[model samples]
Target: MSRAIRRNSLTEQATDALLDYIAERQLGEGDSLPPTGELAATFEVSVPVIREAIAALSGIGLLRRQQGRESVVAAPGATHLSRLLTLRVAHAAVEDDAIQQYREVVEVGSARLAASNRSEESLRELDDALADLRAVADDESLHAADIAFHAALARASGNDLFVLTIDALQPLLHRLRRRVWSGWVNSGGDLTSIVEAHATILERVRERDADGAARAMTDHLAQARLGLDVLSGHVGDSPARD
Candidate 1:
Protein backbone atom coordinates (compact mmCIF):
# COMPACT_ATOMS: atom_id res chain seq x y z
CA MET A 1 0.00 0.00 0.00
CA SER A 2 1.05 3.56 -0.61
CA ARG A 3 -0.14 6.88 0.82
CA ALA A 4 -3.73 6.77 1.98
CA ILE A 5 -6.00 9.30 0.34
CA ARG A 6 -8.02 11.61 2.56
CA ARG A 7 -11.71 10.66 2.72
CA ASN A 8 -12.88 14.02 1.50
CA SER A 9 -10.54 14.22 -1.52
CA LEU A 10 -10.04 10.56 -2.26
CA THR A 11 -11.46 10.54 -5.76
CA GLU A 12 -9.68 13.69 -6.93
CA GLN A 13 -6.31 12.55 -5.56
CA ALA A 14 -6.69 9.14 -7.09
CA THR A 15 -7.64 10.69 -10.41
CA ASP A 16 -4.46 12.77 -10.45
CA ALA A 17 -2.36 9.78 -9.53
CA LEU A 18 -4.00 7.72 -12.27
CA LEU A 19 -3.15 10.39 -14.81
CA ASP A 20 0.43 10.44 -13.56
CA TYR A 21 0.64 6.69 -13.80
CA ILE A 22 -0.51 6.79 -17.41
CA ALA A 23 1.99 9.52 -18.24
CA GLU A 24 4.88 7.83 -16.48
CA ARG A 25 4.22 4.68 -18.48
CA GLN A 26 3.77 6.70 -21.69
CA LEU A 27 0.44 5.01 -22.28
CA GLY A 28 -1.33 5.77 -25.53
CA GLU A 29 -4.80 5.05 -26.89
CA GLY A 30 -6.05 1.50 -26.56
CA ASP A 31 -3.56 0.69 -23.82
CA SER A 32 -5.18 -1.43 -21.15
CA LEU A 33 -5.59 0.17 -17.78
CA PRO A 34 -4.06 -1.65 -14.88
CA PRO A 35 -6.70 -3.27 -12.74
CA THR A 36 -8.66 -1.04 -10.35
CA GLY A 37 -7.67 -3.20 -7.42
CA GLU A 38 -4.01 -2.58 -8.24
CA LEU A 39 -4.67 1.14 -8.48
CA ALA A 40 -6.50 1.13 -5.15
CA ALA A 41 -3.48 -0.56 -3.55
CA THR A 42 -1.08 1.88 -5.17
CA PHE A 43 -2.98 4.92 -3.98
CA GLU A 44 -3.93 3.29 -0.68
CA VAL A 45 -7.51 4.23 -1.49
CA SER A 46 -10.68 2.20 -1.45
CA VAL A 47 -11.77 0.49 -4.66
CA PRO A 48 -14.78 2.81 -4.71
CA VAL A 49 -12.52 5.83 -5.01
CA ILE A 50 -10.55 4.24 -7.81
CA ARG A 51 -13.79 3.51 -9.62
CA GLU A 52 -14.91 7.09 -9.12
CA ALA A 53 -11.67 8.33 -10.62
CA ILE A 54 -12.04 6.00 -13.58
CA ALA A 55 -15.55 7.26 -14.18
CA ALA A 56 -14.33 10.86 -14.19
CA LEU A 57 -11.53 10.09 -16.62
CA SER A 58 -13.94 8.23 -18.88
CA GLY A 59 -16.31 11.17 -18.86
CA ILE A 60 -13.47 13.40 -20.09
CA GLY A 61 -12.70 10.94 -22.95
CA LEU A 62 -9.31 10.14 -21.43
CA LEU A 63 -10.40 6.56 -20.81
CA ARG A 64 -12.85 4.16 -22.46
CA ARG A 65 -14.87 1.33 -21.03
CA GLN A 66 -14.78 -1.85 -23.09
CA GLN A 67 -17.43 -4.57 -22.69
CA GLY A 68 -18.44 -2.69 -19.56
CA ARG A 69 -15.70 -4.56 -17.79
CA GLU A 70 -12.37 -3.17 -18.99
CA SER A 71 -10.92 0.28 -19.33
CA VAL A 72 -8.55 1.46 -22.05
CA VAL A 73 -6.84 4.72 -22.79
CA ALA A 74 -8.60 6.69 -25.52
CA ALA A 75 -6.98 8.29 -28.49
CA PRO A 76 -6.56 12.02 -28.23
CA GLY A 77 -9.43 13.66 -30.09
CA ALA A 78 -12.27 16.15 -29.69
CA THR A 79 -15.06 13.56 -29.43
CA HIS A 80 -16.32 14.38 -25.93
CA LEU A 81 -15.46 18.07 -26.07
CA SER A 82 -17.77 18.66 -29.03
CA ARG A 83 -20.84 17.92 -26.91
CA LEU A 84 -19.68 20.14 -24.07
CA LEU A 85 -18.99 23.00 -26.47
CA THR A 86 -22.29 22.51 -28.27
CA LEU A 87 -24.19 22.52 -24.98
CA ARG A 88 -22.35 25.56 -23.68
CA VAL A 89 -23.02 27.46 -26.86
CA ALA A 90 -26.65 26.41 -26.78
CA HIS A 91 -27.05 27.78 -23.25
CA ALA A 92 -25.64 31.15 -24.40
CA ALA A 93 -23.04 31.25 -21.65
CA VAL A 94 -20.46 31.42 -24.46
CA GLU A 95 -21.07 32.99 -27.82
CA ASP A 96 -20.39 30.98 -30.96
CA ASP A 97 -18.80 34.00 -32.64
CA ALA A 98 -16.25 34.29 -29.87
CA ILE A 99 -15.21 30.68 -30.31
CA GLN A 100 -14.83 31.13 -34.05
CA GLN A 101 -12.68 34.21 -33.55
CA TYR A 102 -10.52 32.39 -31.05
CA ARG A 103 -9.90 29.64 -33.60
CA GLU A 104 -8.87 32.24 -36.16
CA VAL A 105 -6.35 33.81 -33.80
CA VAL A 106 -4.86 30.50 -32.71
CA GLU A 107 -4.79 29.05 -36.23
CA VAL A 108 -3.12 32.13 -37.67
CA GLY A 109 -0.26 31.68 -35.22
CA SER A 110 -0.18 27.95 -35.85
CA ALA A 111 0.03 28.50 -39.59
CA ARG A 112 2.98 30.84 -39.16
CA LEU A 113 4.79 28.33 -36.98
CA ALA A 114 3.94 25.53 -39.41
CA ALA A 115 5.61 27.43 -42.20
CA SER A 116 8.77 27.76 -40.13
CA ASN A 117 8.95 24.40 -38.37
CA ARG A 118 6.95 21.88 -40.42
CA SER A 119 8.74 18.61 -41.16
CA GLU A 120 8.81 16.93 -44.53
CA GLU A 121 6.35 14.31 -43.27
CA SER A 122 4.06 17.07 -42.04
CA LEU A 123 4.32 18.79 -45.40
CA ARG A 124 3.29 15.57 -47.06
CA GLU A 125 0.36 15.28 -44.67
CA LEU A 126 -0.77 18.78 -45.57
CA ASP A 127 -0.53 17.99 -49.24
CA ASP A 128 -2.56 14.84 -48.76
CA ALA A 129 -5.20 16.57 -46.70
CA LEU A 130 -5.58 19.32 -49.28
CA ALA A 131 -5.77 16.79 -52.04
CA ASP A 132 -8.54 15.03 -50.18
CA LEU A 133 -10.32 18.33 -49.71
CA ARG A 134 -10.26 19.02 -53.42
CA ALA A 135 -11.73 15.64 -54.23
CA VAL A 136 -14.77 15.89 -51.96
CA ALA A 137 -17.85 17.21 -53.76
CA ASP A 138 -20.48 17.13 -51.03
CA ASP A 139 -20.70 19.68 -48.23
CA GLU A 140 -20.25 17.11 -45.46
CA SER A 141 -17.11 15.63 -46.97
CA LEU A 142 -15.78 19.08 -47.69
CA HIS A 143 -16.28 20.15 -44.10
CA ALA A 144 -14.42 17.07 -42.89
CA ALA A 145 -11.58 17.73 -45.30
CA ASP A 146 -11.42 21.33 -44.21
CA ILE A 147 -11.07 20.32 -40.58
CA ALA A 148 -8.43 17.74 -41.51
CA PHE A 149 -6.40 20.35 -43.38
CA HIS A 150 -6.38 22.65 -40.36
CA ALA A 151 -5.54 19.78 -38.03
CA ALA A 152 -2.63 18.87 -40.27
CA LEU A 153 -1.31 22.40 -40.06
CA ALA A 154 -1.59 22.37 -36.28
CA ARG A 155 0.49 19.21 -36.10
CA ALA A 156 2.97 20.64 -38.59
CA SER A 157 3.61 23.53 -36.24
CA GLY A 158 5.75 21.12 -34.18
CA ASN A 159 3.97 22.19 -31.03
CA ASP A 160 2.06 19.45 -29.26
CA LEU A 161 0.26 21.96 -27.07
CA PHE A 162 -0.94 23.86 -30.11
CA VAL A 163 -2.10 20.64 -31.69
CA LEU A 164 -4.08 19.64 -28.60
CA THR A 165 -5.59 23.08 -28.18
CA ILE A 166 -6.77 23.11 -31.75
CA ASP A 167 -8.02 19.57 -31.49
CA ALA A 168 -10.23 20.58 -28.58
CA LEU A 169 -11.85 23.27 -30.73
CA GLN A 170 -12.58 21.02 -33.71
CA PRO A 171 -16.16 20.27 -32.70
CA LEU A 172 -17.08 23.93 -32.75
CA LEU A 173 -15.13 24.45 -35.93
CA HIS A 174 -16.90 21.54 -37.57
CA ARG A 175 -20.26 22.95 -36.54
CA LEU A 176 -19.57 26.29 -38.17
CA ARG A 177 -17.84 24.77 -41.15
CA ARG A 178 -20.73 22.47 -41.91
CA ARG A 179 -23.35 25.19 -41.60
CA VAL A 180 -21.47 27.70 -43.74
CA TRP A 181 -20.42 25.15 -46.34
CA SER A 182 -23.92 23.78 -46.78
CA GLY A 183 -25.36 27.26 -47.05
CA TRP A 184 -22.78 28.17 -49.64
CA VAL A 185 -23.55 25.13 -51.71
CA ASN A 186 -27.28 25.79 -51.52
CA SER A 187 -26.75 29.40 -52.54
CA GLY A 188 -24.73 28.35 -55.61
CA GLY A 189 -21.41 29.47 -54.17
CA ASP A 190 -18.19 28.33 -55.81
CA LEU A 191 -16.45 25.44 -54.08
CA THR A 192 -13.35 26.13 -56.11
CA SER A 193 -12.81 29.35 -54.23
CA ILE A 194 -12.75 27.50 -50.93
CA VAL A 195 -10.21 25.04 -52.32
CA GLU A 196 -8.12 27.89 -53.60
CA ALA A 197 -8.03 29.50 -50.16
CA HIS A 198 -6.56 26.34 -48.67
CA ALA A 199 -4.19 26.04 -51.58
CA THR A 200 -2.89 29.54 -50.99
CA ILE A 201 -2.12 28.70 -47.37
CA LEU A 202 -0.43 25.45 -48.41
CA GLU A 203 1.66 27.26 -51.01
CA ARG A 204 2.91 29.67 -48.39
CA VAL A 205 3.78 26.80 -46.10
CA ARG A 206 5.72 25.13 -48.90
CA GLU A 207 7.62 28.34 -49.62
CA ARG A 208 8.45 28.67 -45.90
CA ASP A 209 6.92 32.14 -45.88
CA ALA A 210 5.59 32.55 -42.37
CA ASP A 211 4.07 35.98 -42.96
CA GLY A 212 2.38 34.83 -46.13
CA ALA A 213 0.98 31.77 -44.46
CA ALA A 214 -0.39 33.80 -41.59
CA ARG A 215 -1.89 36.41 -43.90
CA ALA A 216 -3.43 33.78 -46.15
CA MET A 217 -5.03 32.09 -43.15
CA THR A 218 -6.37 35.40 -41.85
CA ASP A 219 -7.94 36.26 -45.17
CA HIS A 220 -9.40 32.78 -45.50
CA LEU A 221 -11.08 32.96 -42.12
CA ALA A 222 -12.38 36.47 -42.80
CA GLN A 223 -14.10 35.25 -45.91
CA ALA A 224 -15.46 32.22 -44.05
CA ARG A 225 -16.85 34.39 -41.27
CA LEU A 226 -18.58 36.57 -43.84
CA GLY A 227 -20.15 33.52 -45.39
CA LEU A 228 -21.26 32.17 -42.03
CA ASP A 229 -22.88 35.50 -41.23
CA VAL A 230 -24.78 35.45 -44.51
CA LEU A 231 -25.97 31.91 -43.82
CA SER A 232 -27.42 33.02 -40.50
CA GLY A 233 -29.32 35.92 -42.17
CA HIS A 234 -27.06 38.43 -40.45
CA VAL A 235 -25.48 39.51 -43.75
CA GLY A 236 -28.43 39.77 -46.08
CA ASP A 237 -26.59 42.35 -48.16
CA SER A 238 -23.14 40.76 -48.27
CA PRO A 239 -22.61 37.30 -49.75
CA ALA A 240 -19.64 35.55 -48.20
CA ARG A 241 -18.07 32.05 -47.59
CA ASP A 242 -16.21 31.67 -50.81
Candidate 2:
Protein backbone atom coordinates (compact mmCIF):
# COMPACT_ATOMS: atom_id res chain seq x y z
CA MET A 1 0.00 0.00 0.00
CA SER A 2 1.27 3.45 -0.88
CA ARG A 3 1.34 6.14 1.77
CA ALA A 4 -0.94 9.09 1.15
CA ILE A 5 0.46 12.58 0.86
CA ARG A 6 -0.67 15.29 3.28
CA ARG A 7 -1.56 17.95 0.78
CA ASN A 8 -2.90 20.48 3.26
CA SER A 9 -1.15 22.78 5.69
CA LEU A 10 -1.83 22.52 9.42
CA THR A 11 -4.11 25.56 9.41
CA GLU A 12 -6.08 24.26 6.43
CA GLN A 13 -6.33 20.86 8.10
CA ALA A 14 -7.69 22.43 11.26
CA THR A 15 -10.24 24.48 9.35
CA ASP A 16 -11.39 21.45 7.36
CA ALA A 17 -11.66 19.32 10.45
CA LEU A 18 -13.83 21.87 12.18
CA LEU A 19 -16.04 22.25 9.13
CA ASP A 20 -16.42 18.51 8.73
CA TYR A 21 -17.32 18.23 12.38
CA ILE A 22 -19.99 20.84 11.96
CA ALA A 23 -21.47 19.08 8.95
CA GLU A 24 -21.29 15.56 10.36
CA ARG A 25 -22.77 16.62 13.68
CA GLN A 26 -25.56 18.56 11.93
CA LEU A 27 -24.66 21.80 13.60
CA GLY A 28 -26.76 24.60 12.21
CA GLU A 29 -26.12 28.31 12.28
CA GLY A 30 -25.67 29.79 15.79
CA ASP A 31 -24.74 26.37 17.23
CA SER A 32 -21.59 26.36 19.34
CA LEU A 33 -18.59 24.42 18.17
CA PRO A 34 -15.96 22.79 20.36
CA PRO A 35 -13.39 24.88 22.20
CA THR A 36 -10.29 26.01 20.32
CA GLY A 37 -7.98 24.27 22.80
CA GLU A 38 -9.81 20.99 22.27
CA LEU A 39 -9.60 21.33 18.51
CA ALA A 40 -5.89 22.22 18.66
CA ALA A 41 -5.16 19.14 20.73
CA THR A 42 -7.26 16.99 18.45
CA PHE A 43 -5.38 18.25 15.42
CA GLU A 44 -2.04 18.04 17.24
CA VAL A 45 -1.21 21.66 16.41
CA SER A 46 -0.53 24.68 18.59
CA VAL A 47 -3.56 26.45 20.02
CA PRO A 48 -2.53 29.66 18.32
CA VAL A 49 -2.58 27.97 14.91
CA ILE A 50 -6.09 26.74 15.53
CA ARG A 51 -7.11 30.20 16.69
CA GLU A 52 -5.71 31.69 13.50
CA ALA A 53 -7.65 29.23 11.36
CA ILE A 54 -10.81 30.01 13.27
CA ALA A 55 -10.25 33.70 12.83
CA ALA A 56 -9.76 33.33 9.08
CA LEU A 57 -13.00 31.41 8.71
CA SER A 58 -14.76 33.92 10.92
CA GLY A 59 -13.60 36.76 8.71
CA ILE A 60 -15.27 35.05 5.75
CA GLY A 61 -18.56 34.79 7.72
CA LEU A 62 -18.37 31.05 8.13
CA LEU A 63 -17.81 31.23 11.89
CA ARG A 64 -18.31 33.59 14.80
CA ARG A 65 -16.48 33.70 18.11
CA GLN A 66 -16.78 35.30 21.50
CA GLN A 67 -13.91 35.72 23.86
CA GLY A 68 -13.94 32.99 26.56
CA ARG A 69 -16.67 31.08 24.73
CA GLU A 70 -16.74 28.34 22.15
CA SER A 71 -16.84 29.47 18.53
CA VAL A 72 -19.92 28.70 16.42
CA VAL A 73 -20.47 27.95 12.76
CA ALA A 74 -22.47 30.65 11.01
CA ALA A 75 -24.03 30.84 7.61
CA PRO A 76 -22.21 33.05 5.16
CA GLY A 77 -23.93 36.25 4.04
CA ALA A 78 -23.39 38.96 1.43
CA THR A 79 -21.69 41.39 3.87
CA HIS A 80 -18.29 39.70 3.99
CA LEU A 81 -18.52 38.89 0.30
CA SER A 82 -19.31 42.55 -0.42
CA ARG A 83 -16.24 43.66 1.51
CA LEU A 84 -14.10 41.21 -0.42
CA LEU A 85 -15.46 42.54 -3.71
CA THR A 86 -14.77 46.13 -2.74
CA LEU A 87 -11.19 45.25 -1.86
CA ARG A 88 -10.77 43.40 -5.16
CA VAL A 89 -12.10 46.36 -7.18
CA ALA A 90 -10.08 48.93 -5.24
CA HIS A 91 -6.94 46.89 -5.90
CA ALA A 92 -7.85 46.60 -9.56
CA ALA A 93 -8.45 50.35 -9.83
CA VAL A 94 -4.76 50.89 -8.98
CA GLU A 95 -4.14 49.49 -12.47
CA ASP A 96 -6.86 51.42 -14.24
CA ASP A 97 -6.42 50.21 -17.83
CA ALA A 98 -6.47 46.54 -16.90
CA ILE A 99 -9.40 46.99 -14.50
CA GLN A 100 -11.47 48.76 -17.19
CA GLN A 101 -11.04 45.84 -19.55
CA TYR A 102 -12.14 43.32 -16.91
CA ARG A 103 -15.08 45.48 -15.90
CA GLU A 104 -16.22 45.63 -19.51
CA VAL A 105 -16.17 41.85 -19.77
CA VAL A 106 -18.18 41.38 -16.56
CA GLU A 107 -20.73 44.01 -17.59
CA VAL A 108 -21.27 42.41 -20.97
CA GLY A 109 -21.67 38.95 -19.49
CA SER A 110 -24.12 40.23 -16.87
CA ALA A 111 -26.20 42.04 -19.49
CA ARG A 112 -26.40 38.95 -21.66
CA LEU A 113 -27.56 36.89 -18.73
CA ALA A 114 -30.16 39.48 -17.83
CA ALA A 115 -31.52 39.45 -21.36
CA SER A 116 -31.67 35.68 -21.56
CA ASN A 117 -33.17 34.92 -18.18
CA ARG A 118 -35.31 37.82 -17.10
CA SER A 119 -39.02 37.01 -16.72
CA GLU A 120 -41.88 39.44 -17.05
CA GLU A 121 -42.13 39.95 -13.33
CA SER A 122 -38.38 40.44 -12.97
CA LEU A 123 -38.38 42.86 -15.88
CA ARG A 124 -41.19 44.77 -14.26
CA GLU A 125 -39.18 44.94 -11.08
CA LEU A 126 -36.27 46.31 -13.06
CA ASP A 127 -38.49 48.93 -14.66
CA ASP A 128 -39.75 49.93 -11.24
CA ALA A 129 -36.18 50.27 -10.03
CA LEU A 130 -35.32 52.37 -13.07
CA ALA A 131 -38.25 54.67 -12.35
CA ASP A 132 -37.04 55.03 -8.80
CA LEU A 133 -33.59 55.89 -10.07
CA ARG A 134 -35.04 58.67 -12.23
CA ALA A 135 -37.02 60.02 -9.32
CA VAL A 136 -33.92 60.18 -7.08
CA ALA A 137 -31.57 61.36 -9.83
CA ASP A 138 -29.97 64.23 -7.88
CA ASP A 139 -29.83 62.61 -4.46
CA GLU A 140 -28.27 59.69 -2.57
CA SER A 141 -31.54 57.84 -3.11
CA LEU A 142 -30.62 57.41 -6.79
CA HIS A 143 -27.50 55.50 -5.84
CA ALA A 144 -29.48 53.00 -3.79
CA ALA A 145 -31.98 52.60 -6.60
CA ASP A 146 -29.19 52.12 -9.08
CA ILE A 147 -27.77 49.34 -6.92
CA ALA A 148 -31.16 47.69 -6.68
CA PHE A 149 -31.61 47.80 -10.45
CA HIS A 150 -28.28 46.09 -11.03
CA ALA A 151 -28.97 43.51 -8.32
CA ALA A 152 -32.33 42.70 -9.89
CA LEU A 153 -30.63 42.18 -13.25
CA ALA A 154 -28.20 39.75 -11.60
CA ARG A 155 -31.04 37.82 -10.03
CA ALA A 156 -32.74 37.70 -13.42
CA SER A 157 -29.66 35.94 -14.79
CA GLY A 158 -31.14 32.69 -13.39
CA ASN A 159 -27.74 31.42 -12.34
CA ASP A 160 -27.13 31.30 -8.61
CA LEU A 161 -23.39 31.71 -9.06
CA PHE A 162 -23.91 34.77 -11.26
CA VAL A 163 -26.30 36.22 -8.70
CA LEU A 164 -23.87 35.61 -5.84
CA THR A 165 -20.94 36.98 -7.80
CA ILE A 166 -22.84 40.18 -8.56
CA ASP A 167 -24.03 40.39 -4.95
CA ALA A 168 -20.39 40.21 -3.88
CA LEU A 169 -19.56 43.00 -6.32
CA GLN A 170 -22.20 45.36 -4.89
CA PRO A 171 -19.93 47.29 -2.52
CA LEU A 172 -17.46 48.02 -5.28
CA LEU A 173 -20.22 49.03 -7.65
CA HIS A 174 -21.69 51.37 -5.04
CA ARG A 175 -18.34 53.05 -4.46
CA LEU A 176 -17.75 53.48 -8.16
CA ARG A 177 -21.24 54.87 -8.62
CA ARG A 178 -20.75 57.42 -5.87
CA ARG A 179 -17.54 58.64 -7.45
CA VAL A 180 -19.09 58.77 -10.91
CA TRP A 181 -22.27 60.51 -9.78
CA SER A 182 -20.42 63.10 -7.73
CA GLY A 183 -18.16 63.83 -10.66
CA TRP A 184 -21.07 64.07 -13.07
CA VAL A 185 -22.91 66.42 -10.78
CA ASN A 186 -19.88 68.63 -10.40
CA SER A 187 -19.10 68.64 -14.14
CA GLY A 188 -22.67 69.49 -15.12
CA GLY A 189 -23.12 66.15 -16.86
CA ASP A 190 -26.84 65.46 -17.07
CA LEU A 191 -28.10 62.59 -14.87
CA THR A 192 -30.80 62.01 -17.50
CA SER A 193 -28.09 60.77 -19.84
CA ILE A 194 -27.35 57.86 -17.55
CA VAL A 195 -31.04 57.23 -17.09
CA GLU A 196 -31.47 57.08 -20.85
CA ALA A 197 -28.55 54.68 -21.14
CA HIS A 198 -30.13 52.40 -18.56
CA ALA A 199 -33.43 52.66 -20.30
CA THR A 200 -31.86 51.62 -23.59
CA ILE A 201 -30.22 48.62 -21.90
CA LEU A 202 -33.47 47.69 -20.23
CA GLU A 203 -35.35 47.89 -23.52
CA ARG A 204 -32.87 45.54 -25.17
CA VAL A 205 -33.20 43.17 -22.25
CA ARG A 206 -36.95 43.31 -22.57
CA GLU A 207 -36.70 42.49 -26.26
CA ARG A 208 -34.48 39.49 -25.40
CA ASP A 209 -31.60 40.84 -27.46
CA ALA A 210 -28.73 39.47 -25.46
CA ASP A 211 -26.01 40.82 -27.73
CA GLY A 212 -27.59 44.23 -28.00
CA ALA A 213 -28.15 44.42 -24.27
CA ALA A 214 -24.54 43.44 -23.63
CA ARG A 215 -23.27 46.10 -26.04
CA ALA A 216 -25.52 48.71 -24.49
CA MET A 217 -24.27 47.93 -21.01
CA THR A 218 -20.67 48.11 -22.18
CA ASP A 219 -21.27 51.53 -23.69
CA HIS A 220 -22.94 52.69 -20.51
CA LEU A 221 -19.98 51.62 -18.39
CA ALA A 222 -17.58 53.33 -20.76
CA GLN A 223 -19.52 56.56 -20.44
CA ALA A 224 -19.56 56.13 -16.67
CA ARG A 225 -15.77 55.74 -16.63
CA LEU A 226 -15.44 58.92 -18.67
CA GLY A 227 -17.55 60.81 -16.14
CA LEU A 228 -15.55 59.39 -13.24
CA ASP A 229 -12.20 60.19 -14.84
CA VAL A 230 -13.33 63.72 -15.62
CA LEU A 231 -14.52 64.20 -12.05
CA SER A 232 -11.18 62.95 -10.67
CA GLY A 233 -9.40 65.45 -12.97
CA HIS A 234 -7.44 62.64 -14.54
CA VAL A 235 -8.63 63.13 -18.12
CA GLY A 236 -10.58 65.46 -20.38
CA ASP A 237 -13.94 64.45 -21.91
CA SER A 238 -12.36 63.81 -25.32
CA PRO A 239 -10.44 60.53 -25.79
CA ALA A 240 -6.83 60.79 -26.97
CA ARG A 241 -5.95 59.39 -30.39
CA ASP A 242 -3.87 56.22 -30.36
Whole-model Cα lDDT per candidate?
Answer: 0.84, 0.80
Worst 10 residues of 2 by lDDT: 93-102
Which digits, one per residue and each the tens of the lDDT, describe model 2 over residues 21-127?
A: 78888999999977878888888899998998998889899899888899988988777887886777677665444445556777678889989988999899989
Model 1, 128-229: lDDT tens digits are 999999999777888889989999999999988778767777877787787777656566668898899999999999999999999999988876776667
- Which regions of candidate 1 are displaced past 4 Å? 1-10, 13-45, 61-77, 80-93, 182-189, 236-242
TM-score attained by model 2: 0.71
Give the Å error, residue 96, model 2: 6.5
Task: Give TM per candidate.
Answer: 0.71, 0.71
